[model samples]
Target: MTHKILIADDEPNIVISLEYLLQREGYAVLVARDGQEALDTIAREQPALVLLDVMMPHKTGFEVCQAVRADEAL
Candidate 1:
């Protein structure tokens, strides 16, 4: 099965590059422009992995990580 990967970053270049690279390797990629969106996407998509930015709009990467860990369902 194709594993889903989430790229959570506000940088367009990084997101585009990573998406292209991961897609080329046949992995399904999802994107979030900000930390809040990242959290929402994470909950909805349940991606196998997430590439998050340390600093983002709405919330930080560390905050997102903490939320994920704190949530038992996630």
Candidate 2:
């Protein structure tokens, strides 16, 4: 199966580049422009991996990681 990867960053260029590279590598990519969106996408898509930005808007990457870890269902 093709694994789904989440790219959680506010920068458009980085998102585009990463999406291109990952897609070329045969992984299904999902993008989230901010931390809150990242968290929501994570819950909905259940990506196998997340490439997260540390200083995103709404919530930091640390906060997102903590939230994921805290949630038993995730």
Q: Least lDDT summed over 10 consecutive residues: which range in candidate 2?
A: 65-74
Best by TM-score: 1
Report the lDDT tens digits of candidate 2 across residue range 9-72. 9999999999999999999999999989999999999999999999999999999999999998
RMSD for each of the candidates: 0.4, 0.6
Q: Report the C-alpha lDDT of model 1 over 33-69, residue by residue, as the tens digit.
A: 9999999999999999999999999999999999999
lDDT for predicted candidate 1 compared with the true structure = 0.98
Query: What local distance difference test score does each model get?
Result: 0.98, 0.96
Point out where model 2 deviates above 4 Å.
none
TM agreement with the true structure for every prediction: 0.98, 0.97
